[model samples]
Target chain A: MKKIFFSFVMSFVAPMLFSQSYKPVQVNFKPMFGSQELVLNDSVYTFNLKDSVYIETLKFYISGIELLCKNKMVWKENNSYHLINLSEENTLHLMLQVPKNIHFEHIKFYLGIDSGMNTSGAQGGDLDPTKGMFWTWQSGYINFKLEGKSNACATRKHEFMLHLGGYLYPYNTIQTIVLPMPAKTSAIIVIDIKTFLSAIDLSKQHHIMSPGNNAFLLSQIVAKSFSPWIAPSKK
Target chain B: MDSTFQKISIIFFLLVLLTAFVWVEETAFKIPDNWPKPKYDFTKNPLSENKIELGRILFYDPILSKDSSISCSSCHLQYTAFTHMDHALSHGIGDSMGTRNAPALMNLAWHSNFMWDGAINHLDVQSLAPISHPDEMGENIVSVVYKLNRNKKYRHLFAASYHLSSITGEQVLKSISQFMLTLVSSHSKYDSVMRKQSLFTNQEKNGYALFQKNCSSCHTEPLFSNFQFVNNGLALDPDLRDYGRMKISGDAKDSLKFKIPSLRNIEFSSPYMHDGRFKTLNQVLNHYTKGIQKNNTLAKELETPIILSANEKVDLIAFLITLTDRQFLFNPAYGFPK
Candidate 1:
């Protein structure tokens, strides 16, 4: 009985003690609007004579993060789900624990919550239903949410909303993003909101607020808008 | 040496105390004879007495509504098999009405999908729909959680059940699910006859035979539902024009198809149908006999009209009345918490 008792205690305490041996890797996310850092509601970006947008709410899930070396698996974050909200400063950065001497050349992650987690019952932390990313009338996470005002829209106050998510077959909007980068203690990735907006025909798809074909297509465009942050100089 | 001996004795006493606390906490949920295992994964959120009690309180509390004027019980009263007695379409706060009848809450753990359209995929998250619907509670889960956090009684109850200081959306939804999952109705006369504990009347026997021939394919026995979405040939109401499953699936073939509800406790749970169009058992039987509106999406069994003599219809209703579990309807355990 004493042996069983000690083993049970060790099971939980062992993980907490073991994980501290690894070095912490910082992954920073920089939300960009065209050539500048995107401000919540104060900044406006104009794409054309009739198209201008000011983002009011921007939030999405970054999940299932993995690091690869020589096209092979190296390290993976356990329970890796992050809800990145533009309005919250601290949430924009993720600290990943990695082995001190582990080698990696690529960082890969999913742009939304995976299908398994979608069907699984209530989740906590970043995947909490109270976070406003979950659909109330249905059962799936809103992978990408963007609420803003656009000049192209004719609705009340010219506002637009796009909530992209679907876990079922044929309409699964979860996208995988893999990028080649040098391994370091810290790295920055830019989410270019301007590129995503320009790629869309604003007049037609200004209000894709549900999971469907439009959300699936728009999710592909969202995937292409991401890139490693470049340092601009000599302007 | 004396101190070491004392420490071991104290540890043993603490372990005994913990065991007693757990022993008194959980009330075992037993599966009835010859019933299929429940689809709900109880291991994830195991049932406990305190959790179920907390859930019962939340189920009756009107704080979940927008104006604090209605609750889950407003539409689903316990005596009437947890369904609104006379309201055709469900009523909400501020005198607003919903588009469909409020579905009865019984034998829920057997169901994988919820709603007339199967919009809700899981039982744990099903509360989100009515809570946020414009015509129903008209309240969001975020606001509900915020309200729960501020309430002293709810917070104290939550802490007892989950042992968490702060209440969360997951805890709130899971606690409600625990209560709903416990509402199992298995002690009906139909079940007693099936188990050979009682003999069915000759009229009920004839009705059972007729039901198996015409209705058992869809409203299968044991659970009394195949749990499929089908077009039962009710013509669309032009004002509401609900396309049912097609709205969620976006498939043309799934148009006008709604989930087949279980017939358990059918005697008390009325008016019938998704829109609550049928007022009595006769109206519903007559619809199947003569009122089918033929469409491409109609059920295969309904392609041939069910011919029932007037006397046979009475016998069929007599058998249906045998499905009412008086114990389940009157169980104080499922009633308002003290």
Candidate 2:
């Protein structure tokens, strides 16, 4: 009777002890132009272009997401840079899990790559240099990529890939993003690209590749886009 | 058939087969009769046939690239002294052009540093640069390890080589370095002359004298490089704006400094310099003679202009040519596995 009871307990407890699950969160990206909005089916994001802008190519990376609850840090995933290549699809879906029993006041992350990763040699996944996020001659990461053709521009439909990344002194693209969580279960941060276009005056600055005032400003705008959706309604 | 006696017999047969295999692959490396002892402390990673074989496969395999398009062999080809000859600039995945020229890779165990700038301090970490460079192998060590770990063939190879069920990044890098360190190039005609097995022609003899007088101060003999840092006085590049040693040391005194490259096989390895600017031997000699610009940190030996005439230049070129080791270049063992 003793041996049978022990076996029964082992069978019931083994799976429960081994299995670890995390709460899931979904982010929907939408592009917009003027008052019109286009839902990206694959990665469809809205970009509010003040004027007609020719879209050639758009690529960028998002990284460094941390989950927290009740002012206690729970899970921190650093150096997680993922490219958002718009040419491939119209919408994007990224499903990530936040470990259970995590307590924190808010969730924090970064829009661009961290400083260490920019110089951490080649990496797999989204951080690979072959992904076109790395510069060959110069040692730096291309933080935010935006390139297209415009008649008003002097280059005029010329190939443009604005790789914005600088980690050294004077120029640093490692921007911090903080999101306040709702009173409920999880936090969902949506990046509205249409808002990004409206925030920038393209007539003043069209292309930016290196880390400078432009990168710092652009990263700030991107971070701001995530702030509004930080704590959705409790409904 | 399923009795204990049959099982014991099968185990005994397996042990004998394993011993036979070990014996067959037990070919040990023999250092050249008179060369200096290798600086690599082989005890850290013992010289074994299985590790070396696996290293060679990884070195030649293109799966290290993101799209499986480029490999170490793409730049460090076996022939032409293991330095690419197709273009001065080394090309990586997606036809991206690297800023620096691919240096010849041989006698690596004797050298203490790597790259034109010596960014990496250890041989174990040297492969990391190329593996991650956007214009080179264009892959990460982690991804490469994961890819290898997922493959059945690599799992078996790793088991045989490292006795591990799965391979790690450290193992992968070390294994490749093992094969590269085995690329000993001490069998050149120059080496034979040192051993008194052959004789140099009159022109070659004269060339050696000139090399000793003008070039030996920097391009030392035996290794053909003193493994020292010096400023040879190449003008600053405007576009790339690369400042070689200073960039790493962060010291202004070391500005424009570069690791002195080995003159061994200078014939096939061109164009020269960190950027491969000088394509001909004459151009290099001319730079040493008339082109060396005065700088605060220039090598004292090259501070004064080297005044070599046409004949002297020819003689120096002849001596540099003798450093070529044809035996090592065409060695079938270094070739791709059939």
- lDDT measured at residue B240 in model 1 versus the true structure, 0 to 100: 90
Model 1: pairs clashing at backbone N, Cα or C within 3 Å: none
Kept native contacts, fraction for each prediction? 0.75, 0.00
Query: At residue A88, what lDDT does model 2 achieve?
Result: 61
Supply the global lDDT for candidate 2.
0.72
Measured as a fraction from 0 to 1, the native contacts recovered by model 1 come to 0.75
TM-score of chain A of 1: 0.92
**Cα lDDT of model 1 by residue, A96-164, tens digit:** 988887889989999999988888778788888999998878789999998899988888898889999
On a 0 to 100 scale, what is the lDDT of residue B199 in model 2? 92
True contacts kept of 2: 0.00
Worst 10 residues of 2 chain B by lDDT: B21-30
lDDT of 2 by residue, B1-338 (tens): 56898999997898678667656654566777866777665766666888888889988999988889988888888887788874677888888999888998888887866788766555665776888887787777668888998999899998887676777765786788789889988877788899999998888999898888888988877888888888899998898787898775557888888899887777888778888888888888888888887889888998777788898888778877888888888898798966
Please give me the DockQ of candidate 2 compared with the native complex. Answer: 0.03
Which 10 consecutive positions of candidate 2 chain A have the poorest summed lDDT?
A: A38-47
In angstroms, the error of model 2 at B61 is 1.2
